[model samples]
Target: MSSSPATRRMSASQRIIVDITDWNRFLFAGKPISGVHRITLGLLRAWKKLGLPFEIIRHDPETNRHKIISHRFIEEDFSEPIHIGGGRIEYSYNKYVQRRTRYFTELAKAKLRRFVKKKEVVHEDFIEGNYEPQADDLLYFCGAGWDAPETMHAAHKWKAQHPGFRFVVLVHDFIPLINKVYRNRLGTRQFRRWFRDAARSADEFICISDNTQADFMLHWRRCGGQGVPRCRVVTNPHEFLSVSDTRNQPMSNGELSAETFLANRNRRYLLTVGTLSSHKNLERLLSAWNTLNFFRDPEADLVIVGDNDPRDVRSLSPIRRNVFLFQKPPDDILKLLYMNAFCSIFPSLYEGWGLPVGESLWFGKVCLCSKSSSIPEVGQDMCPYFDPYSTEEILLALTNALFEKDYIPSYEKRIDRGRMKSWATYGSEIHTALLKMT
Candidate 1:
């Protein structure tokens, strides 16, 4: 026998289309590719490996016009135009905004136009009843948000028109749930509406963690939007490590290996990795570390690996001289740091899913994480947990994880758990889920 088939069989399957917005880049100027993108690419690769025929479609907003450009990745062709209004003019007025917007917008629109013009035009608007889906085609929307209500409405309409086709949506975060308190300029009503519509329309909702899925469910119930699509928890997959490649390549930006950096600096220190944002609670971590005398040793360093936010710097003046802040290091260096660090400290106020906790465990690093949100889920008992709200609690945890000579529980359990949850295992789970969906 070949194997057991898990995915549900469709009545008349034509082709699978995996769609995403901003598929080219990862989380908010962090990297061209990242954890989510890696999983997406991995899924595509897995489909190909299994000989599953599918097409990848990416819809990017056109900078100059009120439209969106769609490309068919499998055919290397572009499809019909999707009219989505652009907000370039309004965005350009903000002086603090990065200048790369114009360049990126123009480049995306040009590339999309060229690709579409070269391919057979499908001018039918699935959203506006310009075209109807055939029994064979299925559309999977990944990392889509409520910000585009029209897209969701269109997908729902198309699904209704073609009952045989599958339409799935992947929810990356419950942003409104945790970020509602920080609604300064972004209208709270608008954000809530987007979340409501997304929960209502999606056929299948893919959540990055069980905690996220539960949060969505709770919010949906509270909003009286029951009977939403089935929410499934799928842990994001990390790139499989190649021992040889990691060994051969320079870990840092060719500056210094994390091991070497730590060796020269000091043996005792608490490390944190993330962009310097309010949610990260970096200042609190620093205050706690200072109070505990965790880094009293003159050589000890509290190294942070991420870009510092100017807003945060302004709010918390007199930046500590001992706190070494480096612009985001490359992945290899990060992995090396996790492998060698005395302890990894993450005191985020909230997280949809704590990636660093899982990552630190994967590298066998003792991690000190906050009990808030999904951090506990990611860290479990493998990490030494702390109350993010209490400076004293965090300080105590930090002190023990760093100075205790026999602090081996966290490290041992991290290695054990990391070994159990490899990328291959994550891929297998996804493969099974996709198969079941079919």
Candidate 2:
């Protein structure tokens, strides 16, 4: 069978005009800081390394339009000294009021965190501008569009203006729609709006997983929508332990950094990386850990490495002992944790792509993950699985693997067979496919 255009690669001589129009978070933070932010930076950096010609653009709040940004803008905001607090920013009269409002929201969040540290907080500091979509340019949303309605609405408007203009969106997941409990009422409603708008606006979608694409299609049908776009299942690329990644790479001495050593205290640990949110099903994992009789491995600790605190797990009866919660540790420390871990555990109930699973596979480590959502799609036959819902099943899987003398070697062999495409390859492939679309 012939490959679809979405999957087909462009010739070497072919070039696509890709306009990345969704830098909503960066525009707010003035830097790529969080995981969501890092995904955009990593992929863009990879594309630049591949010498793919692309432009960065943002929606104009004033006029609600699209426009190409100046290269100087990139240098100023991304590369050089910024306008505010050593950060680059676009200043506008309207945006000034908006940013000031958000500044106070941050203070409010700080106050609220004292009592409810787990609350998901967002305070944006962004600028406004106007732009028009060029003919033959392929628009790419760099992140979730719901956070910036201007960007989402602008895409729809531009599509209406230029009916032949092609655009692609990255579907991280339909987590909110799939599990309503994952998000609050406001977040759920906003994401639903983005989904409906994005489904209508884009010519194609790059799904992070087959499960994600399926979920999107199912939601599309449920919304009484017709004619699904060309959705390609391209999982996120994994960058393995870089011997040269000094920024976040473990030390060559194979010893944890002094600070990390002091923090964790050289204990046998099972690492779980990602936001410590309710969606990750941390509560069940904690419950299982509590029931497992820590006396069997007194030195063993479950280290939750993430930004958001797992508030749901705090309420578990007879909470798991020796639970170490590390909030937003440095990348080098995270690498050290992963490298020294007895085993990595990811008990997320839902995921668009289980990145921690991919990370474990990348590192040739044994990962015991929930056999739910897109996790199995990533793990396949390699990583061990347990039903995240039943605490007993999780405990059963963990006990079998932990007590087994030869399980690590057996699973490491399985990881060797499970290969993933690198970011460099993903960047090159996406460039080719998108050029073809253009």
Candidate 3:
């Protein structure tokens, strides 16, 4: 029997079109890319592995044109996009600048050469006006596809001219549409307009979580979107392990002191891993953590590991001496943190899918997960659920996690199941869906 529904092998005859506009934007603005970027990249790599006939395309933001450009993704294991660092290189200390000088110089030369060779075609990737999309062609917008609405608008006209041109969109979440407080006024308004247009234009839909699909259909009907395409709920494939699997390794990283290290030896740390934002409800966790009677559970510390908003940290009720924020930990350190942590906590009030909750289970650690949105779908019975809105609820969960040795009653099944959710499986599911369109 096949391990997954997506396990069927794909043939090379499949002529699928993919939107890759977001990839270039991510490259230039490279400051720790989002999960969307990672998912898109993983999907592309998976499709290529299947050797299914496909065209990689993107719409030119400047020219409003589109074309298939497959050559851009030949390299793999992309090195960290050179960080320019916080301070300007010109005024920086010599030692610091010298360390990254080679990267900066190469980047400068590359940009200079592009500028020097400027042509009428600022972008060479634009689709020629004469190049019309073929009938029976499938356009898959797997990313947010910021220009999806615009493409759908133009696609309607193109479909009238040509035939059998269909577009499939992947809706990650309805956070912006459903919750105004989640985003700023301008961003929320922009997303609403864009989503409304996308809803009207897209021929079909796929949602990462059930919450997203239900909300999308609700909005589509509410907004009276056209030709409401069939929506599929294909859960995301999570290969959360680093290429270098560091399981079973000792956690003796020298970042912590002898005192903190000794303290951590008794019960290990409580972890929360994800980019901190307003929606994550970390402030409440911090508030609850502060109020916890450390006299009873003094050994445990709360270790937050991810890129986070400084403002959120600053606004924390009171910075606990035991609570440490480890911003942007590398893959190795992160593995250790996950492996050795006593239990993971996710107080996120909203998410397309709570990756940390699954990751915690994947590492065989207990999770104090929220009962909000699609989080429960990821956690199931594997994690201890808590109301993210209530500090008391969070505090109680924390206490249980710290005091109760058997907080996660049974999670062995979850750990085993999470391993089958691979990117190959994800790619296979996506290909199967594409074939259905044909």
Candidate 4:
């Protein structure tokens, strides 16, 4: 995908326009940052730091239009500290309030269906102005876009209006499309529609890993997509979050300090970071721990840190006493967890790029990971791996990692941090690739 020197430079009037509609939606809903969001934020930060010429735009679904967004606006929002209920009682009370709100909302919805005429929920547009596209500008969606049909429609419209404009979509994974079990009927249908629309609208595509690129091509052919667009693989940064990042700020009074939290645990805990989604294979990992009777050890524990789903929590009910779950932990606490953990584990059955594996390895920790999909691309031979499908293999791997005295030390010694690319490097490479495409 290399371009000749002549076409690698951007003209004075040209600029890259980043679409962060997904990020805005998530922020409005008070959602926790996911891996994809982190990747987008990292790139944005890198580009800003390196003085890359770029403008930010967000597609307003309510207005069915795009608007210019300032980088400072997003940066300030990220800089604000997160407030999660810290104490056990406060956390319990917050959970109670959430449950009550959900229950009443559902009840009201049921009543309204029976007694009231249904009407469309109107939304007020808060964005100041609509974005007018420049012919030479590169329009890119770096954040999640599968759920934004309106945004995709707008992108398609713009591409048609401005023939010289290039619209690029970043494909994270084909999980909902490839694996039916991970999503419901409605979710699967939505994803199918999104992929078709996104692929149809884009002039070019970017995949997080080589495996993801292969998956994209396979599905593109299956769907009978037209002439292939220029696609590239730009693996995400492996570096961990630094203190300068917004998430590393001090917690509020209600939240537990990492040092105090670890002191309370008073045990060497193994860390696993990721949402308890079906694709994460948490059940298999838990089974491996159970089979080894590792939970019976008083001095050892398992720390599960990630956003939690009610259905997933129900499915994995009656969690072991030694298995402590920290739902939606702040980044600072998470960093300390990684720092103090005995080791880390990533048992995801599939991923575009197993970020937790890279994060674990970044801290010089041995990450017992699944040898599936794009996971191996993140850790390679630096960490041990096991088949996510087989409980026997998971058990064996866990046993070896726990029992072997030199297991963690051996991996730490070989961690070659020099090989890991920083976020600035990742952004620069992507910027260069975009320039070449133009």
Candidate 5:
């Protein structure tokens, strides 16, 4: 018996190129803000640490083409042109004028899809004709969503034409459709279709979590799809280091310690950090917090540090009295908050990997997360769990966590656990996974 061609090809040094269509300046044109952006930055840092010979190809809106900005030493390169819709503008804004402008821009861009497709064809032809004279050169497609259809198509075409190359798709999450919270977005359907196509076409699939891999398998089965690539769950890495020097660090930028923020000199407070979105189940958390009488106790303040989604801004009005929501804060301040807080509460209804769960644990702070999606896989037993749907259960859990005087874990135990789960270890795991793929 012998292994298949795919298995044989995996054992070699290869030049890898990752396509990031929705990253960095592209996602945040005006300001550097967004969870995805921050996460992407962390991943890039980790990739650099791995010392892999790879390049990042990003879509440039001005040129309507993918350009390699990071690694430029390669001789043969193909720039894929991507067709983007104006729907983002409409989805992001609500005013009539803004909507009209967005609609028109989208319509115009939609009409230019054929042109973009042609440019991609030309680029592929140039690569095939000029560069890939040898057969061993491999190209890997890495990304989650359907935002880069052109690059995906190019990868597929190149793989078919140059049978030696390998293509891999990165699966982030399958909740955009299955989860009712985000069903309204038309782009979700487009992304799903693209994901299916890319998954089927790729030589392998890289899943961010085991939960995501299971969800993707279920999705593929539901759609009567077959021949999907083998998937390997590789958790995203958090490369941020703990600040060694927190002495005299100013927490005065509206970012206060858990003790001061709670307005109680003696009692502990619960904390949650993430965007204020419907899927986050903040309303339920707030309802539970209110029931626990956190505000009156003067010892418990539910400090939320993240920007609020404009659509859900009004939903937060009723809970505004007790909940302290900071739009944005520096990473140092956030790290300090995580360290000082009694516990970090993450009641998200769904998540791809639940970065905060690991992050909180990394800081030696206990986490209270819902036993839903990928949270349990990340939190384990170190952090308490709660049923996200049941407000009463959440309330009970919070009360026990805060009011019970003897419920605290030993400080030495926490430090021991935190030492075992640092970002360096995470980065090493990811590096090993990439090496296996090569």
Candidate 6:
């Protein structure tokens, strides 16, 4: 599913119209970007770098209109590097400033366009012109659309208005449906509605992993979806590994760098990145860690990152002093922790596509993750796997990863960085798939 530069571009008349409605919402929410958001941003950058003819649009819920976002505006405002490092106050201040800047920038552009009445658009969020999809145009939604029901409604409307144009939805995972008990009740309901609507509206499906594709097909069929749309699997890439380069940045006042923090502790650490959600299997991981008696080991420490909810910390408070949890660490700090870790553990019971597994492999670290779902597809032979549900298996893997002298180095030697999937290849595969359907 690879494509050369020449084959990646569509014809002059046809274009890939990416729906960034959710992307805008993510930015506006001022919350830490999730894996889905990162994927959306990465794909946009990849497509832009490939010189593909594309336009970005956001659905306006108030008016039920799709606003064409200026490519220049996106490039200038968002395409900058993302590094949300610092303490709580600094992070909040930065996010607030960013939001206000973007808000004013878009508002000013809109006002300036009205005053000048120029034909050439500079930077407008809501463009004056209406966009009618051409027969060959591909309308793609590559972001998390379940959060925005308006996007799904727009997709349905677009499919009805322009029957000839192709509409596609990128399926990240069916976790919300599969692991409903582990998710928010209202969110899961919305996910079902979104998936059903997408299945009915889309002419093609782009799944992030093989397992996700199978789940999507199974659910689609069970839901009594209409005529089958061509489905394809275009796996997520490991470009995030490159974000570990934070050597040149100045250290924040009174804050120790991740490297210094680790050095000060003077201990080896096993790292895990994810929320405290039950599906992540953190409770199981903690059980194994405690059973192993590493909680009392001064030479070893278990550092948990990405659990922002304070209520979830109550369960973990029982752990001994050696266990550490850094809630919502910055990307740079997280990458640094990965770089200096003894190993990484992902005890997720299920996953759509395991980002932590891919990330660990990218860093050439020993990753002990679950055997279930799409994780193995990312880890392959570079890491050891075990049943996430089995504490014994997890403990065994942990013991081997920690005690076995050559266990990690052996796997690390096999890490072929060059063979790893990249965002460019990901974009090319999606483009090729769309071309095939056309």
lDDT tens digits, residue span 1-438, model 2? 111223555444333443444453445445434454456656666666666676666643222334445444332223212331123433222221244587467545545544564542221222223444655556777576666555656667767787666768888887777554385665666677677777777788888788888888788866545685687876776554221122443222124332455465655667887664668877777778877764466357777776544453455635445665665455556676777778898988888888788777777678998998889987887888888888899888778767777876688777753267577776766666576566
Instruction: Estimate, for each residue in 1-438, the C-alpha lDDT of model 5 and write its tens digit.
Output: 111122122335465656665542333343433454445444455556555455566544433445555332121111111122222211112112234678467646754764675653333311222123124444444444455555666677767776667776767777676656554465556656676676556777778789998988888766546765488886764334431223243333245543345344344556687775667888788788776674455366577776665336435445454556644445665676777788888988888878777777777777888999888777666767889889988887788777776555742154345334444455455445555665
Candidate 2: residue 146 Cα off by (Å): 1.2
Collision pairs in model 3: none
> lDDT tens digits, residues 59-90, model 3?
54333456556434533333244212222112
Give all candidate RMSDs, comma-separated.
Answer: 8.2, 8.7, 8.8, 8.1, 8.3, 7.5
Of the two candidates 3 and 5, the one with more favorable lDDT, higher being better, is 3
- Collision count for each candidate, in order: 6, 7, 0, 2, 0, 0
**What does the lDDT come to for candidate 2?**
0.62
Decoy 4 TM-score against native: 0.82
Is candidate 1 or 5 superior in TM-score? 5
Q: Is candidate 1 or candidate 4 better by lDDT?
A: 4
Q: Output candidate 6 Cα RMSD.
A: 7.5
Any residue pairs clashing in model 6, and if so which?
none
- TM-scores of the candidates in the order shown: 0.71, 0.76, 0.77, 0.82, 0.74, 0.81
lDDT of 4 at 161: 87
Q: Which pairs, if any, clash in model 2?
A: 60-129, 66-131, 66-132, 67-131, 67-132, 82-87, 82-88
RMSD of 5: 8.3
Q: Write the per-residue lDDT of candidate 6 for residues 1-438, one digit (tens) a residue.
A: 244454454677777888776654545545445678678767777878887667877654333356666555334333233222111111111111234587467556555654675453222333534456676778888888766555666667766776667888899888878763256665566677677777777888889899998998789876668767578888888656332233444332125444456658777889988877868888888888887884434367888777445456546646556667666455676777888899899999888899888887778787887998899888888888898889999988988888888998898887877767878888777777777766
Q: Local distance difference test, per candidate?
A: 0.57, 0.62, 0.65, 0.71, 0.58, 0.70
lDDT, model 1, position 267: 50
- Cα lDDT, model 6, residue 186: 56
Superposed Cα deviation of residue 378, candidate 6 (Å):
0.4
Residue 218 displacement (Å), model 3: 1.5
Off by over 4 Å in 1: 1-14, 24-42, 45-53, 60-133, 144-153, 179-191, 222-229, 237-268, 293-295, 310-321, 409-414, 417-419
